[model samples]
Target: MSAKLTFLGHSGFLIDDGATTLAIDPFLTGNPKATMSAEEVRCQFIALTHGHADHMGDALAIARRNDANVIAAFEICNYFEEKGHGNVNPGNPGGRIDTEFGWVALTQAFHSSSFEGRYMGMPCGVVAHIGDKTIYHLGDTTIFRDLELIGEIYRPDLVLVPIGDRFTMGPELATRAAEMIGAPRAVPIHYDTWAPIEQDPAQFAPQGVEVEVMQPGDTLQLD
Candidate 1:
Protein backbone atom coordinates (compact mmCIF):
# COMPACT_ATOMS: atom_id res chain seq x y z
CA MET A 1 0.00 0.00 0.00
CA SER A 2 3.00 2.29 0.04
CA ALA A 3 3.88 2.94 -3.58
CA LYS A 4 5.31 1.24 -6.65
CA LEU A 5 7.68 3.09 -8.99
CA THR A 6 8.16 2.04 -12.59
CA PHE A 7 10.75 3.45 -14.95
CA LEU A 8 9.46 4.11 -18.46
CA GLY A 9 12.77 5.38 -19.89
CA HIS A 10 14.24 8.84 -20.41
CA SER A 11 12.63 10.76 -17.56
CA GLY A 12 9.31 8.89 -17.73
CA PHE A 13 7.93 7.12 -14.66
CA LEU A 14 4.73 5.42 -13.60
CA ILE A 15 3.78 5.53 -9.93
CA ASP A 16 0.98 3.56 -8.28
CA ASP A 17 0.02 3.86 -4.66
CA GLY A 18 -2.59 1.11 -4.87
CA ALA A 19 -5.32 3.78 -4.76
CA THR A 20 -4.22 6.06 -7.57
CA THR A 21 -2.05 5.74 -10.68
CA LEU A 22 0.22 8.58 -11.76
CA ALA A 23 2.55 8.88 -14.77
CA ILE A 24 5.36 11.40 -14.93
CA ASP A 25 6.71 12.64 -18.26
CA PRO A 26 5.22 10.24 -20.80
CA PHE A 27 8.18 10.30 -23.21
CA LEU A 28 7.52 6.81 -24.37
CA THR A 29 6.20 6.95 -27.91
CA GLY A 30 9.47 7.78 -29.69
CA ASN A 31 11.94 6.54 -27.11
CA PRO A 32 13.76 3.39 -28.11
CA LYS A 33 13.84 2.05 -24.56
CA ALA A 34 10.22 2.91 -23.84
CA THR A 35 7.94 -0.05 -23.31
CA MET A 36 4.49 1.49 -23.81
CA SER A 37 3.21 3.73 -26.54
CA ALA A 38 1.14 6.86 -26.00
CA GLU A 39 -2.16 5.03 -26.48
CA GLU A 40 -1.06 2.06 -24.41
CA VAL A 41 -0.08 4.03 -21.29
CA ARG A 42 -2.66 4.18 -18.50
CA CYS A 43 -2.79 6.53 -15.58
CA GLN A 44 -5.16 8.65 -13.50
CA PHE A 45 -2.74 11.58 -13.29
CA ILE A 46 0.20 12.80 -15.41
CA ALA A 47 2.85 15.04 -13.90
CA LEU A 48 5.12 17.12 -16.12
CA THR A 49 8.23 18.88 -14.81
CA HIS A 50 8.85 21.04 -17.81
CA GLY A 51 7.63 21.93 -21.29
CA HIS A 52 10.47 20.35 -23.23
CA ALA A 53 9.33 18.04 -26.05
CA ASP A 54 11.19 15.02 -24.74
CA HIS A 55 9.76 15.40 -21.25
CA MET A 56 6.29 16.34 -22.44
CA GLY A 57 6.31 13.67 -25.12
CA ASP A 58 2.91 12.18 -25.86
CA ALA A 59 1.45 13.63 -22.66
CA LEU A 60 -1.47 15.29 -24.38
CA ALA A 61 -2.35 12.21 -26.37
CA ILE A 62 -2.08 9.93 -23.36
CA ALA A 63 -3.97 12.25 -21.05
CA ARG A 64 -6.76 12.75 -23.53
CA ARG A 65 -7.19 9.09 -24.25
CA ASN A 66 -7.00 8.06 -20.59
CA ASP A 67 -8.94 11.10 -19.30
CA ALA A 68 -6.23 11.78 -16.76
CA ASN A 69 -5.46 14.98 -14.93
CA VAL A 70 -2.23 16.65 -16.07
CA ILE A 71 -0.14 18.51 -13.50
CA ALA A 72 2.45 21.04 -14.64
CA ALA A 73 3.54 24.67 -14.58
CA PHE A 74 0.96 27.39 -15.18
CA GLU A 75 1.88 28.18 -18.76
CA ILE A 76 2.28 24.52 -19.68
CA CYS A 77 -1.07 23.77 -18.09
CA ASN A 78 -2.69 26.52 -20.10
CA TYR A 79 -1.06 25.23 -23.24
CA PHE A 80 -2.43 21.74 -22.63
CA GLU A 81 -5.87 23.19 -21.90
CA GLU A 82 -5.73 25.09 -25.15
CA LYS A 83 -4.90 21.83 -26.84
CA GLY A 84 -8.35 20.66 -25.61
CA HIS A 85 -7.49 18.85 -22.40
CA GLY A 86 -9.04 20.87 -19.62
CA ASN A 87 -8.16 18.52 -16.80
CA VAL A 88 -4.91 20.30 -16.02
CA ASN A 89 -3.96 21.43 -12.52
CA PRO A 90 -1.59 24.35 -12.82
CA GLY A 91 1.23 24.40 -10.25
CA ASN A 92 4.27 26.53 -9.53
CA PRO A 93 7.39 26.28 -7.49
CA GLY A 94 6.45 26.03 -3.79
CA GLY A 95 2.81 25.27 -4.65
CA ARG A 96 0.95 22.08 -3.76
CA ILE A 97 -1.88 20.21 -5.45
CA ASP A 98 -4.16 17.70 -3.77
CA THR A 99 -4.58 14.44 -5.67
CA GLU A 100 -6.71 11.39 -5.03
CA PHE A 101 -3.94 9.70 -3.09
CA GLY A 102 -2.25 12.67 -1.40
CA TRP A 103 -0.58 16.03 -1.91
CA VAL A 104 2.05 16.72 -4.60
CA ALA A 105 4.29 19.71 -4.03
CA LEU A 106 5.89 21.62 -6.87
CA THR A 107 9.60 22.18 -6.25
CA GLN A 108 12.16 24.32 -8.00
CA ALA A 109 14.25 22.99 -10.88
CA PHE A 110 16.88 24.95 -12.83
CA HIS A 111 15.97 24.31 -16.44
CA SER A 112 14.58 25.93 -19.53
CA SER A 113 10.84 25.75 -20.13
CA SER A 114 9.74 25.81 -23.72
CA PHE A 115 7.61 23.59 -25.93
CA GLU A 116 7.45 23.81 -29.70
CA GLY A 117 9.01 27.28 -29.88
CA ARG A 118 6.57 28.59 -27.26
CA TYR A 119 8.11 29.92 -24.08
CA MET A 120 6.36 28.23 -21.17
CA GLY A 121 8.06 29.58 -18.08
CA MET A 122 8.55 28.08 -14.63
CA PRO A 123 9.76 24.52 -14.86
CA CYS A 124 9.49 22.48 -11.64
CA GLY A 125 10.01 19.14 -9.95
CA VAL A 126 7.40 17.20 -7.94
CA VAL A 127 7.42 15.99 -4.34
CA ALA A 128 4.65 13.45 -4.08
CA HIS A 129 3.41 11.97 -0.81
CA ILE A 130 1.49 8.74 -1.06
CA GLY A 131 0.71 6.65 1.98
CA ASP A 132 3.81 6.85 4.23
CA LYS A 133 6.34 7.29 1.42
CA THR A 134 7.51 10.50 -0.17
CA ILE A 135 9.24 10.63 -3.59
CA TYR A 136 11.17 13.33 -5.41
CA HIS A 137 11.71 13.51 -9.16
CA LEU A 138 14.34 16.17 -10.02
CA GLY A 139 13.27 16.62 -13.63
CA ASP A 140 15.84 17.89 -16.18
CA THR A 141 18.28 20.07 -14.30
CA THR A 142 21.84 20.55 -13.17
CA ILE A 143 23.36 20.25 -9.74
CA PHE A 144 22.35 23.11 -7.46
CA ARG A 145 22.98 23.87 -3.79
CA ASP A 146 19.31 24.41 -2.97
CA LEU A 147 18.79 20.68 -3.36
CA GLU A 148 19.84 20.48 0.30
CA LEU A 149 16.96 22.79 1.10
CA ILE A 150 14.56 20.60 -0.87
CA GLY A 151 15.86 17.55 0.94
CA GLU A 152 15.34 19.22 4.30
CA ILE A 153 11.82 20.17 3.37
CA TYR A 154 10.52 16.92 1.82
CA ARG A 155 12.85 14.17 3.12
CA PRO A 156 12.11 11.97 0.15
CA ASP A 157 12.42 8.19 0.25
CA LEU A 158 13.33 7.83 -3.43
CA VAL A 159 14.90 10.37 -5.77
CA LEU A 160 14.89 10.27 -9.58
CA VAL A 161 17.59 12.30 -11.32
CA PRO A 162 18.87 12.98 -14.81
CA ILE A 163 22.38 11.78 -15.56
CA GLY A 164 22.49 12.83 -19.16
CA ASP A 165 25.03 15.44 -20.21
CA ARG A 166 24.71 18.13 -22.95
CA PHE A 167 21.35 19.06 -21.39
CA THR A 168 21.56 17.86 -17.78
CA MET A 169 24.03 16.77 -15.11
CA GLY A 170 26.12 13.78 -16.05
CA PRO A 171 27.56 11.20 -13.65
CA GLU A 172 30.01 13.57 -11.98
CA LEU A 173 27.43 16.18 -11.18
CA ALA A 174 24.75 13.58 -10.50
CA THR A 175 26.99 12.12 -7.82
CA ARG A 176 27.17 15.53 -6.22
CA ALA A 177 23.41 15.89 -6.65
CA ALA A 178 22.81 12.63 -4.83
CA GLU A 179 24.85 13.91 -1.93
CA MET A 180 23.01 17.21 -1.87
CA ILE A 181 19.53 15.69 -1.99
CA GLY A 182 20.38 13.21 0.78
CA ALA A 183 17.84 10.65 -0.34
CA PRO A 184 17.97 7.09 0.93
CA ARG A 185 17.74 5.69 -2.58
CA ALA A 186 18.53 7.38 -5.90
CA VAL A 187 17.95 6.28 -9.50
CA PRO A 188 19.57 7.68 -12.63
CA ILE A 189 17.55 8.58 -15.71
CA HIS A 190 17.64 10.73 -18.87
CA TYR A 191 20.71 9.11 -20.29
CA ASP A 192 21.64 7.10 -23.40
CA THR A 193 18.81 8.69 -25.39
CA TRP A 194 21.41 9.95 -27.90
CA ALA A 195 25.08 10.59 -28.27
CA PRO A 196 26.86 13.28 -26.21
CA ILE A 197 24.76 12.14 -23.22
CA GLU A 198 25.64 8.49 -22.96
CA GLN A 199 26.79 7.21 -19.53
CA ASP A 200 27.42 4.03 -17.60
CA PRO A 201 25.48 3.60 -14.35
CA ALA A 202 28.29 1.61 -12.77
CA GLN A 203 30.59 4.62 -12.97
CA PHE A 204 27.90 6.76 -11.31
CA ALA A 205 27.15 4.40 -8.43
CA PRO A 206 28.98 5.44 -5.30
CA GLN A 207 28.89 4.67 -1.58
CA GLY A 208 26.24 5.79 0.92
CA VAL A 209 23.59 6.00 -1.78
CA GLU A 210 21.53 3.08 -3.03
CA VAL A 211 21.87 3.64 -6.75
CA GLU A 212 19.36 1.71 -8.81
CA VAL A 213 19.97 1.55 -12.53
CA MET A 214 16.53 0.73 -13.85
CA GLN A 215 15.89 -0.25 -17.43
CA PRO A 216 12.75 0.53 -19.36
CA GLY A 217 9.69 -1.29 -17.96
CA ASP A 218 11.55 -2.11 -14.75
CA THR A 219 9.55 -1.79 -11.53
CA LEU A 220 10.81 -0.83 -8.08
CA GLN A 221 8.67 -1.47 -5.03
CA LEU A 222 8.86 1.03 -2.19
CA ASP A 223 7.59 -0.28 1.10
Candidate 2:
Protein backbone atom coordinates (compact mmCIF):
# COMPACT_ATOMS: atom_id res chain seq x y z
CA MET A 1 0.00 0.00 0.00
CA SER A 2 1.15 3.54 -0.75
CA ALA A 3 1.38 6.14 1.99
CA LYS A 4 1.17 9.93 1.90
CA LEU A 5 3.58 11.75 4.19
CA THR A 6 3.06 15.48 4.56
CA PHE A 7 5.66 17.70 6.15
CA LEU A 8 4.14 20.16 8.59
CA GLY A 9 7.26 22.27 9.09
CA HIS A 10 9.73 21.76 11.88
CA SER A 11 9.38 18.19 13.14
CA GLY A 12 5.68 17.79 12.48
CA PHE A 13 4.24 15.41 9.87
CA LEU A 14 1.01 13.87 8.71
CA ILE A 15 1.22 10.22 7.70
CA ASP A 16 -1.79 8.77 5.90
CA ASP A 17 -2.00 5.08 5.04
CA GLY A 18 -5.53 5.13 3.53
CA ALA A 19 -7.08 3.18 6.40
CA THR A 20 -5.55 5.28 9.17
CA THR A 21 -3.92 8.69 9.36
CA LEU A 22 -1.40 9.71 11.99
CA ALA A 23 -0.38 13.23 12.99
CA ILE A 24 3.09 13.37 14.47
CA ASP A 25 4.32 16.41 16.37
CA PRO A 26 1.43 18.54 15.18
CA PHE A 27 2.88 21.84 16.33
CA LEU A 28 1.36 24.33 13.90
CA THR A 29 -0.51 27.04 15.74
CA GLY A 30 2.52 29.20 16.35
CA ASN A 31 4.51 27.90 13.42
CA PRO A 32 5.22 30.66 10.92
CA LYS A 33 5.63 28.11 8.14
CA ALA A 34 2.55 26.10 9.01
CA THR A 35 0.41 25.54 5.95
CA MET A 36 -2.60 24.19 7.83
CA SER A 37 -4.23 24.78 11.16
CA ALA A 38 -4.91 22.39 13.97
CA GLU A 39 -8.60 22.16 13.08
CA GLU A 40 -7.77 21.11 9.53
CA VAL A 41 -5.85 17.97 10.50
CA ARG A 42 -7.94 14.79 10.12
CA CYS A 43 -6.31 11.83 11.78
CA GLN A 44 -7.06 8.85 14.02
CA PHE A 45 -3.82 8.89 15.91
CA ILE A 46 -1.29 11.44 17.20
CA ALA A 47 2.25 10.23 17.87
CA LEU A 48 4.69 12.30 19.89
CA THR A 49 8.42 11.84 20.22
CA HIS A 50 8.94 13.93 23.31
CA GLY A 51 7.56 16.76 25.42
CA HIS A 52 9.36 19.73 23.94
CA ALA A 53 7.04 22.53 22.87
CA ASP A 54 8.24 22.50 19.30
CA HIS A 55 7.36 18.80 18.98
CA MET A 56 4.30 18.79 21.19
CA GLY A 57 2.86 22.08 20.09
CA ASP A 58 -0.85 22.11 19.26
CA ALA A 59 -1.11 18.40 20.06
CA LEU A 60 -3.93 18.84 22.54
CA ALA A 61 -5.86 21.08 20.21
CA ILE A 62 -5.55 18.81 17.20
CA ALA A 63 -6.18 15.62 19.12
CA ARG A 64 -9.22 17.15 20.76
CA ARG A 65 -10.52 18.33 17.42
CA ASN A 66 -10.07 14.99 15.70
CA ASP A 67 -10.73 12.84 18.73
CA ALA A 68 -7.52 11.01 18.01
CA ASN A 69 -5.42 8.97 20.34
CA VAL A 70 -2.14 10.51 21.52
CA ILE A 71 0.56 7.85 21.59
CA ALA A 72 3.70 8.60 23.54
CA ALA A 73 5.66 7.79 26.68
CA PHE A 74 3.77 6.92 29.85
CA GLU A 75 4.23 10.28 31.53
CA ILE A 76 3.43 12.20 28.40
CA CYS A 77 0.21 10.27 27.89
CA ASN A 78 -0.67 10.66 31.53
CA TYR A 79 -0.12 14.40 31.23
CA PHE A 80 -2.52 14.53 28.30
CA GLU A 81 -5.02 12.41 30.18
CA GLU A 82 -4.93 14.80 33.11
CA LYS A 83 -5.75 17.60 30.71
CA GLY A 84 -9.02 15.73 29.93
CA HIS A 85 -7.95 14.51 26.52
CA GLY A 86 -8.80 10.82 26.55
CA ASN A 87 -7.63 7.94 24.35
CA VAL A 88 -3.93 8.20 25.07
CA ASN A 89 -1.86 5.08 24.47
CA PRO A 90 1.03 5.09 26.90
CA GLY A 91 4.11 2.99 26.24
CA ASN A 92 7.86 3.10 26.84
CA PRO A 93 11.00 2.46 24.86
CA GLY A 94 11.55 -1.14 23.66
CA GLY A 95 7.84 -1.99 23.63
CA ARG A 96 5.41 -2.06 20.73
CA ILE A 97 1.73 -1.28 20.65
CA ASP A 98 -0.61 -2.56 17.98
CA THR A 99 -2.97 0.15 16.89
CA GLU A 100 -6.01 0.31 14.64
CA PHE A 101 -3.86 1.15 11.66
CA GLY A 102 -0.68 -0.77 12.39
CA TRP A 103 1.91 -0.69 15.16
CA VAL A 104 4.24 1.81 16.90
CA ALA A 105 7.44 1.03 18.75
CA LEU A 106 9.24 3.46 21.01
CA THR A 107 13.01 3.55 20.77
CA GLN A 108 15.61 5.39 22.80
CA ALA A 109 16.57 8.97 22.01
CA PHE A 110 19.25 11.21 23.53
CA HIS A 111 17.33 14.29 24.62
CA SER A 112 15.29 15.90 27.32
CA SER A 113 11.53 15.69 27.86
CA SER A 114 9.56 18.21 29.83
CA PHE A 115 6.61 20.59 29.51
CA GLU A 116 6.23 23.65 31.73
CA GLY A 117 8.92 22.25 34.02
CA ARG A 118 6.99 19.03 34.54
CA TYR A 119 8.79 15.86 33.65
CA MET A 120 7.08 14.28 30.66
CA GLY A 121 9.14 11.14 30.26
CA MET A 122 12.29 9.89 28.62
CA PRO A 123 12.76 11.18 25.10
CA CYS A 124 12.08 8.63 22.37
CA GLY A 125 12.44 7.65 18.76
CA VAL A 126 9.15 6.56 17.22
CA VAL A 127 9.15 3.61 14.80
CA ALA A 128 5.88 3.37 12.96
CA HIS A 129 4.73 0.57 10.67
CA ILE A 130 1.86 1.72 8.49
CA GLY A 131 0.58 0.56 5.15
CA ASP A 132 3.23 -2.15 5.13
CA LYS A 133 5.97 0.50 5.26
CA THR A 134 8.23 1.28 8.15
CA ILE A 135 9.36 4.84 9.05
CA TYR A 136 11.79 5.83 11.76
CA HIS A 137 11.32 9.34 13.18
CA LEU A 138 14.36 10.00 15.31
CA GLY A 139 13.02 12.58 17.64
CA ASP A 140 15.28 15.51 18.63
CA THR A 141 18.57 13.94 19.62
CA THR A 142 22.24 13.61 18.90
CA ILE A 143 23.59 10.99 16.52
CA PHE A 144 23.94 7.85 18.60
CA ARG A 145 25.61 4.55 17.79
CA ASP A 146 22.43 2.55 18.46
CA LEU A 147 20.94 3.93 15.27
CA GLU A 148 22.76 1.12 13.48
CA LEU A 149 20.99 -1.31 15.76
CA ILE A 150 17.71 0.43 15.12
CA GLY A 151 18.30 0.01 11.44
CA GLU A 152 18.93 -3.69 11.93
CA ILE A 153 15.77 -4.04 13.97
CA TYR A 154 13.22 -1.98 12.02
CA ARG A 155 14.77 -1.70 8.57
CA PRO A 156 12.67 1.34 7.86
CA ASP A 157 12.24 2.47 4.28
CA LEU A 158 12.37 6.11 5.29
CA VAL A 159 14.02 7.94 8.16
CA LEU A 160 13.08 11.39 9.47
CA VAL A 161 16.03 13.09 11.15
CA PRO A 162 16.82 16.47 12.67
CA ILE A 163 19.43 18.60 10.93
CA GLY A 164 19.42 21.52 13.32
CA ASP A 165 22.47 22.28 15.43
CA ARG A 166 22.70 23.20 19.13
CA PHE A 167 19.54 21.30 20.01
CA THR A 168 20.03 18.31 17.76
CA MET A 169 22.36 16.79 15.22
CA GLY A 170 23.37 19.14 12.43
CA PRO A 171 23.91 18.39 8.73
CA GLU A 172 27.17 16.46 8.93
CA LEU A 173 26.07 14.44 11.93
CA ALA A 174 22.64 13.85 10.43
CA THR A 175 24.19 12.66 7.19
CA ARG A 176 26.36 10.20 9.05
CA ALA A 177 23.32 9.09 11.03
CA ALA A 178 21.37 8.31 7.88
CA GLU A 179 24.20 6.15 6.68
CA MET A 180 24.36 4.34 9.97
CA ILE A 181 20.62 3.68 9.83
CA GLY A 182 20.92 2.56 6.21
CA ALA A 183 17.53 3.92 5.23
CA PRO A 184 16.90 4.14 1.52
CA ARG A 185 15.45 7.64 1.92
CA ALA A 186 15.77 10.43 4.46
CA VAL A 187 14.05 13.74 5.28
CA PRO A 188 15.48 16.69 7.22
CA ILE A 189 13.52 18.48 9.93
CA HIS A 190 13.71 20.52 13.18
CA TYR A 191 15.59 23.38 11.60
CA ASP A 192 15.14 26.76 9.88
CA THR A 193 12.04 27.46 11.92
CA TRP A 194 13.87 29.43 14.60
CA ALA A 195 17.06 31.38 14.95
CA PRO A 196 18.56 29.05 17.48
CA ILE A 197 18.33 26.23 14.93
CA GLU A 198 18.76 28.21 11.70
CA GLN A 199 20.29 26.15 8.91
CA ASP A 200 20.68 25.83 5.17
CA PRO A 201 19.06 22.47 4.57
CA ALA A 202 20.66 22.14 1.14
CA GLN A 203 23.94 21.37 2.86
CA PHE A 204 22.40 18.25 4.40
CA ALA A 205 23.41 16.02 1.52
CA PRO A 206 24.23 12.60 2.89
CA GLN A 207 27.03 10.70 1.19
CA GLY A 208 25.63 7.98 -1.01
CA VAL A 209 22.15 8.55 0.42
CA GLU A 210 18.93 10.01 -0.90
CA VAL A 211 18.07 12.97 1.28
CA GLU A 212 14.79 14.69 0.56
CA VAL A 213 14.42 18.25 1.85
CA MET A 214 10.68 18.82 1.76
CA GLN A 215 9.18 22.27 2.13
CA PRO A 216 6.47 22.98 4.60
CA GLY A 217 3.23 21.29 3.53
CA ASP A 218 5.01 19.24 0.87
CA THR A 219 3.94 15.63 0.49
CA LEU A 220 5.98 12.52 -0.34
CA GLN A 221 4.25 9.39 -1.50
CA LEU A 222 5.87 5.98 -1.19
CA ASP A 223 4.50 2.68 -2.36
Candidate number achieving the greatest lDDT relative to the actual structure? 2
lDDT of 1: 0.89
- Separately for all candidates shown, the number of backbone clashes (residues 3 or more apart, or on different chains) is 0, 0
RMSD of 2: 0.8
Write one digit per residue (lDDT tens) for candidate 2, span 1-223: 8789999999999999988999899899889889998888899999999999989999998888888999999999999899999789999999999997889999999999999999999999999999889999999999999999999999999999999999999998998899999999999999999888999888788776788889998999988
TM-score to native of every candidate shown: 0.97, 0.98
Measured by TM-score, the strongest candidate is 2
Q: Candidate 1 versus the native: TM-score?
A: 0.97
